[model samples]
Target chain A: MLGYIIRRVVAAILVVIISSMFVFAIFFLGPTNAAAVICNQNGRCTQERQALLEHSLGLDQNVVPAYGEFAKGVFVGRTISTGPGAHYDCSAPCLGISYVTKEEVTELLKDKYPATLSVALVGGVVYLFLGCTLGILAAKWRGTTTDKLLVGSSLIVSSIPYYLVALLAWLFLVNEFNLFPKTGYFPITDDPVKWASGLLLPWLVLGVANSPQYARFGRGSMVETMSEDFIRTASAKGLPRNKVLFKHGLRAAIVPIITIFGLDLAALLAGTVFTEKIFDIDGIGKWGLEAIPVDLPVIAATVLVGAVLVVAANLIVDILYSFLDPRVRLA
Target chain B: MTEVLHAREPQPEALPTSDSDPFLVVENLTVQFPTHDGLVQAVSDLTYCVGLGQTLGIVGESGSGKSVSSMAVLGLHDEKRTRMTGSIRIAGKEVVGASDQAMRRIRGKEAAMIFQDPLTALHPFYTIGAQIVEAYRLHNHVNKKTAKQRAVEMLDLVGIPQPDRRVDDYPHQFSGGCGNAR
Candidate 1:
């Protein structure tokens, strides 16, 4: 088991490295000029000024060597300059200085990540629990009016696009009706109540928008599990109805649900662009979205972080599969 | 019209005791299921009885209600989906329309079923010991450790080799014959 985990971890690291390189190459070596964008932002970009900015930012070098410098900056601190006498000491693990803000990309990510994590974790839990419970209940009353109602409602909700739902929720709930508190990111340490109230709308919108898919997945998995012979065996063993449904049936049914959940949560953690944008939360998703066509380093950092999260979530799910099903031997 | 099937006659010498009363009696039991297509009469007017210490062999072609009637004996059919009629008395307790609570007391305590296909009948995710422990713990007020010990003992009693080690193995890990023994 230990050997299997070690191998997975090594493979995950390689995947992250390759994906980071891809992110770097795409943005830095693409048609868009990183130095020119920064120069044009400051003032009219003369040829001399663009060349000076490119040389200072190390964009003038060959792609491989420039990428090497960027990768090295992630491990050890590097000196960054916007123009002459504008040198900034970016600490170790620096992603790069943002073209617009001139702030270290790592520092900006650190500031934005908490909001994204908070929204993702709370909303993820709410949806997972609500969705699975609804699905299980539907499965228990399979072929009944109640089951039809639950399944139909989930389908109706999922049919509508997610962004529209979030937008309508924000417009009515916060703006017109004045039902929920105005949405924004607030540090929990400063004021816990404000933090929760500020985030409550986004959390609910996310949960409501995303839960229908999970409900469908859960219902499908549970219906299949209910037909397994072991379920009959459990019933014959005189286990109480609830125990047989949840312990024996759900224990197996939840394995597939968890696999989907891991990936979904990983995506959310990477960034919830629509939720953050609609709700006005200053999360990584909003930051990354805003960085497009402006801040190349910020975009690269977000993509790199997202790639790492997805790979890590996949590894975690595989490990969890072994624990959930004894038949799944890691070796 | 439903046709009655004959039960194989038991040898007099094979009787454990000369008691005349049958332990299980089913009279005019019918099992039907309502589906999208139509009503499925899985079993109709099934009458049979088996005495204590006597073996009853039910033989028929596929889809001949053999398994359906047996499942009916334990009231295993879904209450909402299935329609059952007549009387099924196990050890003198009527099971045809018994409440779930009453059936729960009888099942796994007074009577238990060994399914035909052991491979799928045993849960794939749980170890053999855990499945046995679940069945044992349902009726008995024993802790998990004690129930697990009994499971190992039961495995050994069934002539399974390395009962202690193999008890922790999943159903798929066991061979066909071993799974059947479990």
Candidate 2:
């Protein structure tokens, strides 16, 4: 088991490295000029000024060496010179200075990440519990009217675009009706009450919007599990209907749900662009979205972060699978 | 050679004696399922009886209502989907059209079923010990530790070696025969 985990961790690291290299290669070697972007932002880009910016940003070097420098910067601290006499001491794991913001990319990510984490974690829990409960209830009722109603409602909810739902929720609940408190992110440490209340609306919207799929997934898995021979054995053993459904049935049913959940939560943590934007929360998603076509460094950093999260999530799901299903051996 | 020949020869069917009393009786039992296409008669007019300490072996091709009939005896069929008629009495208790609560009391206590495929019949997530303990504790008034001990004894009784340690192993860890014993 320890060997299996070590192998998985190594594979995850390799995936992250390859993805980061891909992101760097795209931004550095692509048609878009990193130095030119900064130069154009400052003023009219003369040839000399562009050359000077390129040299300072290390863009003048070959792609291989430039990538090497960037990778090295992520480990040891590197001095980023935007121009002559304008050097910024970017600490270790530096993602470089944002061309537009002039702030360290790592600092910007650190500041915005908590808001995303707060939204994702709270919303994730709400959706998982609500979705799985509804699903299990639907499966228990199986062919009844209640089951039909739950399945039909989930289909209807999932049919609509997610962004539209979030937008309408924000527009009415916060803007028009005064139903919910004003939606924004506040640091939990500063004020826990404000944090909860401020994030309540977004959490609800995210939970409600995403839960329909989870409900369907859970329902389908449970239905299949209920038909397994073990379930029949459980029933024959005189276990109550509730025990048959929950204990014997749900344990096996939840494996697939967890797999889906791990990826979804990782994606959410990477940054909920629509949720953050619609709710006016300053998260990594909004920052990355704003960085497009303007701030190259911030975009690269967000991509790298997203790749790391997805790889980590996949590894976690695989490990979790071994626990949930004994038949699945990691080796 | 003469004795072997006599054994190979077909003998006349033996009739039930007056002293034998049947414990389970199924009379004119018909089970149907309504589907999108039409009604499916899974089992029709099935009549059978089994006396105490007697074994009745049911053999038929797949989808021939063999499993369906046995499941009906235990009231394991989905009440909502299945249409059952006639009478099924297990130890003099009527099973056909019986309420779920009545069936619950009878199941595992009065009668229990062993599924055909032992590999799939055992719950995969739980250890053999846990599954056995669960079944034992359901009808028997005993603590988990006692029930577990009983489970170990039962496993040992079934010719399973290392019953104490093997009880903790999951169904997939056991061989096909071991799983059936479990």
Candidate 3:
């Protein structure tokens, strides 16, 4: 198990490095010239001003050394300058300063992370709990009217585009009904109630929007598990109805669900762009969206962050399988 | 209707609890499944009885109702899907329309079934001992340790060597025959 974990962690790091390189290459190839953009900031860009901007931004250097510096910045801090007179200190794991705001990109990420994590975590909890319960109930009822109703409703919900569902939720629940406080973000440490109230609609919108897919996944898994001979054996063992259904049936069914769950949570944690943008939460998703076309460093940082999260989620899910199914040896 | 079949005659026997009575009785039992096409008669007017000390072997080709009839006795059929009628009594408890609660009480305690294929019958993720322990725990209100001990004991009874050591091994770890014993 220890060896397996070490190998997976190493592999995950390699994956993140490759993805970061891809992000950097894509930004380099992009049509918008970083040097020109910066020089253009001070009115019309003269040839001398563009050259100076290129040298200051390290754009004049070869791509290899520039990438090397970017990589090194993650381990130790690096200084970034827009011009000879304007130098900025970007702390260790420097993602460079924003083109607009002189603040460190990492600092921006730090500020926004709590909101995204809050939404993702709360939304995750709500969806998993609600989806699993509804799926189990539907599986129990099987071909009955209740099962049909649950499955049909889930299908209908999933058929609609997720963005529309989130938009409608915000429009009605927050705007029209005023059932919730205006959707935005507040630090929980400042005021827990306001923080929750502010995010409540986004959480619900994200949770409900994602739940139908989970419900369908859960139902399919459970329905297959229900017919397994062990379930019959469990029933024949005279276990109470609930025990047979939950302990034996659902326990087995939950392994696949956990796989999807880890990935989904990791994706959301990286950012739910639509959910954050629509709800006006100042999160990494919205920040990443706004940074594109102008800020390559922030975009690259978000890409690397997302890749790390996905790889970490994969590792966690693999470890979970060893517990969920004893037959799966870690090696 | 496809084949001219000889329907077995109903055996007149006493209940199994008493000395002269049979342990189990199934009289004129019919099992059918309704599909998109039509009602498929899986078992028609089956009649049989097993005495307390006797073993009944049901032999037939595939698609035969041998497994189906046994499942009916256990009341293990998909209750909402399959159609079962006539009589199936085990220790004087009628299985045909027994309440789910009653069936739950009777199953595994008063009677247990050894399925033909243990590979599909046993849960693959659980160890043989864990599966046995689960079965024991379901019937007995004992804690995990006691149930585990009983599981080892039961495995030993079934002639499995080193029950203590093998108890933690998963189903695939066992040979085909030993897996069946589990």
Candidate 4:
């Protein structure tokens, strides 16, 4: 177990290394230039100011020194100087400096984490429960009218794009009927009521749209699990029907579910740009898209955050594997 | 006058014990399936009973419906696809056609089950003792320490070595092929 933990920790470090390279590479390979963006934003760059920015920001320095500074900030803490507005500690283990904002990418991400987590987790729970319950009921019926309707509805939901559904929901539900407030976001602490209300509609939109796939996934798994001998055994033991379903069948069926959830979390965090835009949420997805052309720091931070979430999800799945099904070994 | 006086006696219940009634009984239970291919009889009019503290085994290879017939008693088998008709009296209470809430109440306290494979039966991440304690505590309102102590006792009873120390060890720590019975 110690060895496994060590190995996992090393692997995590390697992942961060690779992710950092990707972040650097994206900026390097892309058509957009951070310096040009800065120049454009500045209207015109005076020579002294340009030289100061270039030398200080390491445009004048070689890529090695620049990357060395970045790595040092990322891995080992080191203080570095930046603009006059906010005195960034610029300690070691920093992701990078924001080209546009001239702020530490890590700080920017840490500040906004709650928003992303709130949106993802609450929405995830809503969709997961609704989807699984509906799916099980549909599968129980299998060929009846309720089953047909559920399958057809899920199919329709699956066919429609997430953004389009989100848009329709927002416009009609929030704008037309005025049942919900217009697309807006508030921090949970800043205003709990508004925050909950805001996410409620998004959750509905996201849940209704995403739930079909989950329903199908869950139903298929349930159907497959019901055929397993253990389920039969559980039932035969004169265990209640609920026990047969929840105890044996549910656990057996969840392996695939967790795998899907891990992948889904990553995809949602990345693809949630549309949802964020529609809902007017100032989350990383929306901000990342907007900051792409102007600021590399925000983009880098976004990528890092997304990668962290994906890693966390994987860890959670691994831990859950040993829980959901006893056959799995951590080693 | 004699014909008018004569009365028909009721049929005797299957496996009626001398001292007390049997805990569970199944008689003339039929479980069928209607498919595109044909109507398949999964379990056909099978009868069996298990009294309190009695172990009953239904041994058969795959598709023999040994398991299916038993599932019918619990009403665990699907009602729509597979047709089940007959009596399944559990602890003198009818299991078949029983309400969901009522069946849920009978599951763990009145009866709990372990599967053929112990590896699958135990949840991997949790310690065996923890799982057992949880199972015990779920049905009873005992405190954590009391539950833990009971769990430890159960571990010792199940032949787990060093019950106190091993109580915290996860299921993976156990050697393979124990095949624990619940």
- Model 4 scores what on Cα lDDT? 0.70
The i-RMS of every model, in angstroms, reads 0.8, 0.8, 1.5, 5.0
**Which residue pairs in candidate 2 have backbone atoms (N, alpha carbon, C) closer than 3 angstroms, thus clashing?**
none
Please report the interface RMSD of model 1 to 1 decimal. 0.8
Give the winner by lDDT: 1 or 4. 1
CAPRI category for model 2 = medium
Q: Could you tell which candidate, 1 or 3, scores higher by lDDT?
A: 1
Return whichever of 3 and 4 wins on lDDT: 3
Report the lDDT tens digits of candidate 3 across residue range A1-331.
9999999999999999999888987886668888887778879889998898778877788777888888888889887785778887776888877766667889899999999999999999899988888888899888889999999999998889989998888898888998888999999999999999999888887778788888888989999999898888888877788888888898889999999999999999999899999999999999999888778888888888899999999999999988888778898
lDDT of 4 by residue, B1-182 (tens): 23212211212232244456488888777677789998888887788889888999888999999867765555565555765666677777666656555555555667555555666555544566666675676668899899999887877888877888878876556776543723
True lDDT of residue A177, candidate 1: 100
Residue-level lDDT of model 4, residues A24-133, one tens digit each, is 66665567646655765658877666666655555666555666776777777666556433345676557776776666777776666666667777777777888898
Decide which is better by DockQ, 2 or 3. Answer: 2
Clashing pairs in 4: A73-A93, A73-A94, A74-A93, A74-A94, A76-A92, A77-A92, A78-A91, A78-A92, A322-B125
lDDT of 2 by residue, A120-206 (tens): 999998999889988988988888899999999999998999999999999998999999999999999999999999999999989
Q: Output the TM-score of candidate 2.
A: 0.92
The sequence of per-residue lDDT tens digits that candidate 3 reaches over residues B1-182 is 32212221222342345555466889889988889999999999999999777898899999998889988998888766777777888887677767678788778877898886787788777788888887787678999999999988988999989989999888778888888885
Residue A45 accuracy (lDDT) in model 1: 85
**Chain A TM-score of model 3 versus the true structure?**
0.96
Candidate 2, position B109, lDDT: 84
DockQ metric, candidate 2: 0.63
Give the better candidate number (1 or 4) by TM-score. 1
